[model samples]
Target: MDKKEILDTLKAAQVYLSRLKSLDNELESAVKQIINTFEETERNIHDTFSNLKVVLVNILNKRENFLLEQAKKAKTDGLAPLEECRNVISSKVVGTNKLITQGNSIINGSAKDGLAAFSKNASLLGSLPEVPELKEVPFISFHVDPTSDNEVKDILSQLGEVSRIAPIQITELCEKPGAILVEWHSVENDDRLTDIQEFRLQRAFGDVIKEKHLLVNFNDCYRGLDTQFLVKDLKVDQPYSFRVCCKFEGIQEWSPWSLPQVASTSLRPFSWKISDDFLLSNENKIAKPTVDSPKVLYSDGPQFCVGHSVEFTFLEIDSSNAMLGLIDQILPTSSSLTSTPGNSFLVDKSGKIFVDGIEKCTRLSEFSKGLKVCFTCDLVNDHKVRVNVDCNEKRVTYDWSIDPDYKMFFVSQFYSPNWKILVE
Candidate 1:
């Protein structure tokens, strides 16, 4: 009951209070994390279900409309002949009845009247139309199975249990020409599998009901951790939806598919057929026009259609003497490269835009590595040409009048291994 005893008791109380505070802080942190996880799970599930509902409804509606249209058309066609036959039969019956009535009147009339009636009956009989032959109209029958509802119910019952494995999180999706790269991460601290084994990537493109789904497996390539998979051989500029799932080495069941990621592949490179007017120098990397050769390399693809543009991506630009333009006439192989041909529109590397060997615009742009230059020929609008140069995140465009009678080509009179271009 002295001062030392009281101080000792207060110190013990303080230690207890500090421990309780630490426990409370830990509990709050755990609660917040759990709440966040639950919210994410709920959102994902709801979104998936909603999307599935919309897709199913759309499919069902389309099928219903198609079948209804078919049935309606069949009904209209089937009834047309039947209606015509009915009208013909009705007319014949009326004529026969008239003839019968006239014959009866003649039998019951006096001599003069009977003679008149007999003539009338004869006329009626002669004027009657011939009975047309009735051909059988084929009937359309649509069969409906009464047990289909039960069959669907049975199939639904056999879909098995909902997977307990956490869904994959898509981290990155890159679209390239003829290919797509999909990267994903599994749920952290997932204890469903002791060691990760394999992952399955599935993709659906075009009409879901018609297109065959694609499935690729990454077994040894992935060490059961977060990784990426490149899907190749895909059609360019086609939209595709993808999902991922995983399985343990010893487990039989695979995790449920991840949320769908939809993207379209990049446009395919232009089908460029290099002409022999230019020599392939520097290990066939650079196109150089010789002095005695035509300074033009034409593409075998179709001419620039209306609103269709051509883009060139420069991987390397070692020379600034390149010329891009359209030519109306194919110059002879012995033509000199010093003068631009007539009926041509050329853009040179020195920022000179020329039309028919005359300077049109001096606002030309230089090229660099990883730069894209696009030329759009607007033949519909008085044969105008629009040139767009994209470099270093900057773009510049120039508009110039052009001759519609010319074809386009790329001309360069230099040899450099670092001068490569891709036409898109």
Candidate 2:
């Protein structure tokens, strides 16, 4: 072979040698990783069981101390009366023995005037001590609570569990009004949903994302064996993210959290209802204004348990003074819905908003006939109710301290005759 061909052949051999060395190093690294993983898992399991042992020992020790005290007290109390009776009987025997000795001396004539001394105490010697006769021995036996052993065994059986890591992934997230339905499946792609003991679904606000599952303030929404869960009472149009983990039947540890999925709820519409006093036509959606003072019309559907939206369209708003709002309830003898202080929130014809019959803001939006005015209401952090009103492209948002015991409803007040409105 020529010199150049020989050099090329040597270089090829060097490349193959380097590749072989690289493979050897990779193999060594993988072995080290396996050893490290095993050590870590062992340490974690040991620590978990150790902590559980400490807690259980503390609880058992407390119970043991309590029972020991009770047993000791029972023994002392049971022995008390018996000891007293024994002492009384022993004293009487000693006295009787003394008298018998004196009498024996007298009979044998061993002492001067012994007979006379014995005769003087004869009545006392023959009389028995006033010891109460025992009918039945009071047996104080300490019977441990019958279920205590079973309870301990049951606790021990459930104390700690062994589990293998499960490969899981969230498949889909479906949105509903004020809720989200989360679905997941095993990464193995097998039908093992039934084999799982339970699944834990958690949710967090989208803005509160974190790198680790423990870092985020995630709330547990559901825990069960089902592969799907529906989380309810969420805010409307608000961004939320969800993740899931699962455990096997015999396993105590949960699988790692799945990648978070984001979703938002759409506006849910509710059916409207007006009182029979103002009924005119069309399933309580249409009502004629009473000639007397204005009365409020309320909804009969599901209360504002979650976020909802309602639209009020004035079919005829010419020269009619009307108000649209929400009220917690209407009293039967009430002259007007706004009569109950702080229970009513309303907006008037001149684009003014009122809370509890007190005006909050003026000229919020231009109110006119044939225009659709939509009211959007939702809870804010479970403490306040937020309402957004959109009228002819003008939007206004208001928040109020929500009464926990109150069930909210949509309401409107009208006094002008021939005034018509369509509620949707």
Candidate 3:
């Protein structure tokens, strides 16, 4: 044979061998699973039968006791009349015997005594009534229903089979303020012909799972590309539990529900207004507003007035040239504080504070994550600009004389992707 033909045959043989191995593994797994299911079914049946036996025994014992009690009551009730008759007969016999003795005594006595005895006998005979005939009362009988045992047996035999799939489990759950992302996959890894075509996401909202009610049910159409779904529009600072299930496109059945994933939303600040001149990317922008807090604003130029003061807080500062301060000129949208043509105070990632292209503070502690650094421009007090690093109690104040012709506004510039701001 040719070498190419031999190589081709070898590859075909290898593919066939792999398929055979996979089939063998699948068959072994299926056999084990079936055996386990059969054993579980057998155990359940045995338990149910044992319980039934106990229940039936208790019922029969109760019935037997009840019947025995009824029989004793019947015997007592049936013998009452017979006992009264016996007592009456015994009293008559005693009276007759005494009368006979009195007669014999009178016969052997004198005439006066005989007359007295005869008078007493006549009175006693007139007072006596005729005796009634005695008969035995019939016994009461209890009859058992012939069909009851058969009915019970039928009920036991008609036990229904439970049809259910194995439970699925959630592999990962991620959460952000006002949003929750859920990811799950099937546990069985069943490779049936019915491919999963959709996922159902369910959510419950509350501090406790048992106390919570389902608030959302969403169906995500699956294209076999991703196993994750993101649920938005959730309330911040509230606890939520999520579960998901897989459904086939054409089939009506859905896989068993996945185990619930619990998470709570973080505190998200209010959305702020950005100036039209500055370009703001969609990334790192806060969407939802804090319920009780004031609105935040961002502008290309510093919003400075003679009597009014404006403050800006640095939510995040990742860039080396992230700037936040008052500017007297309308800085170019693309320029940083270093290139702006106005008085500007800025903080960098290296913990340095800068003003007008000059370093003012060196190695001051940088703001920690989630810490806010405030920049207040007080035009009322000789255009005094204050930079508070909100870390280590560091504060810097600058006095600048404003030109009457120039308009000043709050300015912020950050080139880093993680830079964020909130104006207060």
Candidate 4:
């Protein structure tokens, strides 16, 4: 019984196992097929969704690209006016640069080109509006008169004898005997606004005439005064031989001197018409002092005959302490250096001037700044006249009363009065 049962159970168990195995295999296969089917459906669905999303995105991008391309084509077609605008901007830049260049040319060069063009057309165009002709030239005038009896002779004697004095020159247009005029032709032609007409003259007494203080009493209508001149104080009174001279400004050159004319003092009141000798018309014995001695009369020197050069000889009195040459030039001081001839026309005589503190040099220049007296003879005429002179290295004259008794004791101590006159 056990065997049979065991066989049947084994068979039953085998069959059931076989069936189970087959069912398990079929179930497994079926599950696998289902899973595969499910996965395949999911994959298909996912692929469709992805394809749809891509199509949507591609449509959106195509719309944007088409809009951009259309806008680009519109811009290209509309560029003509923009091109014109760019050209206008560029033309403005070029015009600005041109204006700036023209402005700079005018400023940097002071508009010289414009001025040159104007000058070329001046005759027809006339001068620039409101502008006047340039008148920078100078006119000079000289006046000389010696009609008086002794005035003529006195002045002539004072003018040192020269080989040839410049002939007295007068304006050919207005020839006046008493008044002499000179023109600095070079300066006149170059800067003149008009022809010089008249000049003022100042007068004083004595050698101071060399100082050249006389103002050129000329009219300004002719032209402007030339500032380019050797401006110096000239003497007014006394005697002088003046010649008009001129020099071009900046051109360091002097024109030949004009003909010289004699200037002498007349006792009469100064008159424009009778500008020269101031003739007294009548006369007397009283006269302006002449060069007869080395001492100045009126006791003191120089003031009276300012432009006169003096070689006073006061012999050294061995017994007297008369202290060097004491010059009290008694001439009354009426005018100032510029107003009227001052005390005298004297200059520094270096060491030669010192008489107990006064000037004692015999060789006194015309405008002797200091009264100079040199000891050559004894002074006797306690009361004598006076002489005048012009100073410095120019025209010179002397005024002194030298005693005939030339030899004196001043010779023993300092002998002949030295000849020394130096201008500082």
Using Cα atoms with residue i matched to residue i, what is each candidate's TM-score against the true structure? 0.35, 0.42, 0.38, 0.19
Q: Candidate 4 — which residues are off by over 4 angstroms?
A: 1-4, 38-64, 74-79, 88-424
Question: What is the Cα-based lDDT of residue 207 in candidate 4?
Answer: 31
Clashes of each: 0, 0, 7, 71
Best by TM-score: 2
Weakest ten-residue segment in model 4 by summed lDDT: 407-416
lDDT per residue as tens, model 4, 75-152 = 675665556766766765665565556556666885656655443433332222232223522222333454664785
**265, model 1: CA deviation in Å?**
13
Residue lDDT tens for model 1, 1-424: 8999999999989999999999999999778756755786778777877886798789889988988898889989878876887787788677678767767766676233556655655664554434345455556667767699688668656744444445566677876434676898876576754566777777676533234343332122233455686665567777777777788768777777665567766634334446555544432334544434244455443344334455666665665456554555556665533375555556565656666677764454576667666665555356666655444455555554664444454333333334555554
TM-score of 1: 0.35
For candidate 3, write residues 329-419 as lDDT tens digits.
6655455566656665566655677777678745556655565555533443443433333445666666555553344555555554455
Tell me the whole-model lDDT of each prediction, alpha carbons only: 0.59, 0.71, 0.58, 0.35
TM-score of 3: 0.38
* Model 2 lDDT per residue over 1-424, tens place: 9999999999999999999999999999778756765786789879988998898899989988998898788788867877887888898788778889997777677866777666776777555545545555445555767698889788777865433433677898776544676788887654555578888988887643434453367888888778887676667787788888888677677866775667877745344565554655664566666565555666664355444556778777646567777777654655565465546678777778877777775456555668788877777766777778888888888777775445677777776665677766
Q: What is the lDDT of residue 127 in candidate 1?
A: 47
